[model samples]
Target: MKVLVVGSGGREHALLWKAAQSPLVTALYAAPGNPGMEALAERVPWDGDLEALAEFAEREGIDLTLVGPEAPLVEGIADRFLERGLLVFGPTQRAAMIEGSKAFAKTLMERYGIPTARYRTFRDPILALEYLEEVGAPVVVKDSGLAAGKGVTVAFDLHQAKQAVANILNRAEGGEVVIEEYLEGVEATVLALTDGKSILPLIPSQDHKRLLDGDQGPMTGGMGAVAPFPMDEATQKQVEEGILKPLIQGLRAEGVLYRGVVYAGLMLTREGPKVLEFNARFGDPEAQAVLPLLESDLVELALRVAEGRLEGARPVWKPMAAAAIVLASPGYPEAPRKGIPLRIPEPPEGVLVFHAGTRLGPQGLETSGGRVLNVVGLGKDLEEALGRAYAFIPQIGFPGAIYRKDIGKKALRR
Candidate 1:
């Protein structure tokens, strides 16, 4: 099967790399892919036009089009491809609103009796500010529209909450602001494959969203991740019953046929597992950490899901632990310092480097985005995997490069 994967992030790199391992994959292409994917796929330039992408897929006889980013999926890329009679792996526009709009997702969850944070949506900034004042401190302020994982703010005080609302309204693409009660708990991520009817969850992973260690500092896309998250069987069963199961039923109830990854950001509180948010695609560092443990052919699994036969196929995974630590440019999640030449050393066994925001410059490979690269490691246990992950950090060099020293520390301590 000829495959075309969309996006240029570390998640896309992992997907392309894993898909390349399948014997069924005859050819693989990445649209506007990063330099890290050069060895695994043929990179083609994209103009952010869905029609052009569909045409390219048709001309190249792409058997399956795997979308990696949420923006295109939210903008109806799957709809465009399906309209052209093309096989694509993603949800339609209306269904994708689960990630495209926070308010929509919250409302749908409420309608379906899905567990989530208590929230209110406001269109006017003034009303949002007033609501924040009423709600008081320690509430979460979120932009209803996508902001690349930076839109949500856990405000500790009323002033910060108002400022977050103001900031959302200040953006050109800003629309509504959702203020929700902050739930206290450890967060975990579940990336599930579904054919709009049944769902198959991958190994649970946890992402460290805060840029600094100890869960302090502002949030970027992700700082690091660990797969096969340390959750007991009871919690896992609770998540399946309280979250994943109801999610698929909710989508089916809405007459939505979702045929791709359903990334559920879950917060395990005393009450039970509550969804923090939903992403239509795989999480970045999470994908880097989790895909290495997949025992089945990624291409075959995706094709089966695209063909709506996921119920007939059984996916497998290796019983191993994996960890990924992200390397960020200076001033990441803000003004990232780009163009700094990168010097990477030879990695030892069990360690893999997945590029995220990097480009080939005239001098050499340079940092091109906030989160530049992911250093992943796999091992028999969480301790060994995390050790292997941290050991590679000293071998790399770049100006003002920042990364958390404690990536899987939470799980390791347990």
Candidate 2:
């Protein structure tokens, strides 16, 4: 079967890699794919143009079209393809509001009694500041709309918290912002495949969101992540029951068939697993970490969901731990300096590099964006995996490249 994977990032690269292993796959294509994905699939230059993509798929007789980024999904690409009687693996535009609009998601969660942080939405700067002052320090400020994973700011002090609110509200177009009560706890990413019903959970993983070492600095897309996170069986069960199930049922009741990956960013607070946010598709670094441990056929599973036959198509996972550490250009989460040449040496055993913001230039790989390559390592445990991940970093040298030193430090302390 021929397939077209959309977007150009580490997540798309990983998807292309996994889908290529399927025996049924005959041809694979990536739209605007990065240099790393060039080896895995044929690279196309389309920037996720819905009509153009659909036309290309039809002309090429593509069997399935897999979306990679949130932009195309938010633009209702799935709905358009479905209208053309094409098979697509993503939720509809209406279903995508779970991630597109934070206010909408919060309302849904409240309606369903799903566990989450207390939050208030505001479009007015003055009212927002008043609420922030009332709520006190250590709150999270989030852009209601998509901001390329850099919109959410977890402020630790009153001054920073107020500034975050001001920055978001004072923007030119002034998008709605959410001020959330910060819940202290370990965070985990749980991605599941569903046909708007029968949910099949993937391996749980934790991501480090801070930009610097020792969990310092501002939030970023993700610095690193580890799969098969050390969550007690009881806590995992609580997340499934208290968070995932209610969410699925609520979406179903709302007549929204979410037939794709449901990514729940949860905080394992003392009260239980409270959702931080809901992403309609897979997480970036989390996808980089989790997909390596998946032993099941991803293409088959995705096809089942697209065909609405996911009842008996549970995915299998390996027992090993997989870690992904992201290497970023200088000044990430702010002014990132690009165009620096990168020198990546031979990867150590059990290590792989998935490119994110890189291009194969005349001089070799060059930094192209804030987050660059995702260096992945697999081992028996988190520490072993982290060691393998770090061992590859020094080999791949780039000027002013930054990464968190404490990739899996939380799991180590636990």
Candidate 3:
């Protein structure tokens, strides 16, 4: 089977790597893939152009097309490919609104009795500020639309919270902002593959979103992540039964046959697992950490979902723990300096580098974005995985590269 993976990031790179390992995969291609992915698949220059991607897939006789990002999915690429009788793995545009629009997702959760934070959406700055004053401090301000994963701000004080609201309501990029009651708890990400009926949950993973070490500074895409989190079996079951089941059933009842990956960003509060947000596709650093432990054939599973036969497929996973630490440019989640030369020494036996913001320059590999590469390490436990992950940081050469020294400290303490 010839496979075409879309997008250009660490997540896409990991997907490409996994797809290449499939024996059924005869040919592999990545559309506008990064430098790391070029080594795994035949790199193409289409950066998720719906029509061009569809045309290329049909012309190249690609057996399956897997989308890795949410932008193209929201642009109706899946529907376009399906119109041409091509097997595309992603949700339709209408269904993708669950991730595309924050307000829409929050409304869905409320209407379906899905537990989440108390939130209100506002478009006017004056009205929003008034609401903010009433709501008080220690809140979260989120951009209603995608901000490249840097839109959400968790303010610890009232002054910071008001500024966050002002930044979103007054900025040119920000339109409507969603202010929600802050829920303090352990944050975890649960991603599952669904056929609009049966949901197959992957191992739960936790991501460090803070830009600085010790979970300080502004929120970023994700600094690092660790899989097989310390959640008890009972808590995991509660999340599945209370959150995932209701979400899946609700979407189905709404006439949205949700197929593809569903990412539930959960805040494991004392009450239970309350969803913070929903991502239509896999999480970034979370994918970097989780995919390495998947023991099943990615190509077969994706094809089954595209064919609407996921009920017959059972995904398998490794018992080992996996951790991914992201290496970022000088200043991230803010002003990031680019064009810094990066020298990555030969990886250790079990470590893999999934490039995020990098390009093959004339000199060598250089920093191309805020987050550079995700260094992944696998081990029998979290400690062993984290040990291997942090060992390679010094070997990777990049000027002003910042990384969270304590990526999985929380889980380790638990």
Candidate 4:
């Protein structure tokens, strides 16, 4: 079957790479794909809109369309593709609003009795400030709409909380602000395949958002990640029953036949596992780390979900672990210096490089976005996986490249 993957990032590259391994996939294509994906997929030009993509899929006879980013799904890309009679794997606009709007997600959780932090929505900055004062320090402020993962502020004090609310409400988009009680604990990401009624959980992964080590520095889209986050079966079951099940039930209660990936950003607190956020599509660096361990054919699995046959779809996974380290350009998470030349060498066994922000330049592969590449390593154990990924980082010679040294240390400490 011919497949068209949407997006141009490390997550998309990883999806393309995994899709390339499926025997059911006859051909692979990517729209506005990065240079690294060119080896496996035929690069196609996109007009940078959902309508154009739907038309292209129809003209190209794309058997399946897999969305990688949240924006496209939130903007109703799947609805457009489905209206044109093209098979696409992504949630519709109504379903994706769980990620598109923080207020919507919080409301869903509150309505369905799903475990999550207590939150309040604010459209006026003055009201937000007053609420912050009432909630006091150690709170979280977030933009109700998407901000590419930079809208969140886990403020340690009242001053920082007010500043975050002011900054978010002051954006050009000018949207509402969501302030919530900060849940204390370690974080993990769990992505699942669903057809609205049925849910299939994938291996859990952990992502680091900070720019530097020791959890210091400003947040980024993602810096590094590790798969198989060492979550016990009991805790995983709690998260599935207490959160994911109710979430799907609520979406159905609202008349949405969702068909796509469901991403849960979890905070495993001393009380129990609670949701921090929900993403309609795949998690970027988490996908980079987790997809490598998937032994099932992605094309077939996604098609089954799109057809609403996910009840019996049993996707397989390897018993191995994976770690991914993202290399970013200079001044990333704020200002990234692009167009710098890159020197990447062929990796050894158990290591794979997925390009996130590079293009074919006059000299060679040059950095084009904030995150340049994702170096992933697979092994029998988490320690070996982390070691292999770090060992191969020095071969890449893109000067001013930034990366987190400790990708899987949190899980290792456990």
Best by TM-score: 4
Q: Give TM-scores for every candidate, taking all chains together and pairing residue i with residue i.
A: 0.98, 0.97, 0.97, 0.99
Give lDDT tens digits, candidate 1, residues 28-57: 999999989999999999979998989999
- Provide the global lDDT of candidate 1 against the true structure: 0.90
Q: Please give the CA lDDT of all the candidate structures.
A: 0.90, 0.88, 0.88, 0.92
lDDT of 4 by residue, 1-414 (tens): 999999999999999999999898998999989999999999988857889889889998999999998888889999999999999999999999999999999999999999999989999988999888888989999889988988899899998888888888877778799999989999999999999889999999999989899888998899999998999999999988988988998889888878899999999999999999999999989999989999988888999999889898887889899999999999898999999999889999999999999988898789998999999999999999988999999988989899988778899998
Per-residue accuracy of model 3 over 1-414 as CA lDDT, tens digit each: 999999889999999999999999999999989888876889899855689989999999999998999898888998999899999888888778888889899999999898999999998988888888898888899988877678898877878877877877887765888999999889999998887887778899999998988888888999999998888899889878888878889988898888888899999999998999998898999999999999999989888888888886777889889999999988786878788999988899778889999988889889888999999989999888888889987898887888989989898888
Q: Which of the predicted structures, 3 or 4, would earn the higher TM-score when compared with the native?
A: 4
Q: What ranking emerges by lDDT with the best candidate at the front?
A: 4, 1, 3, 2
Clashing pairs in 3: none
Off by over 4 Å in 1: 172-174
Error of 3 at 122 (Å): 0.8
Q: How well does candidate 2 score on lDDT at residue 103?
A: 91
What is candidate 4's CA lDDT for residue 286?
Answer: 95
* Angstrom error at residue 368, model 1: 0.7
- lDDT-best of 1 and 4: 4
Q: Model 2 shows how many backbone clashes?
A: 0
For TM-score, candidate 1 versus 3, the one ahead is 1
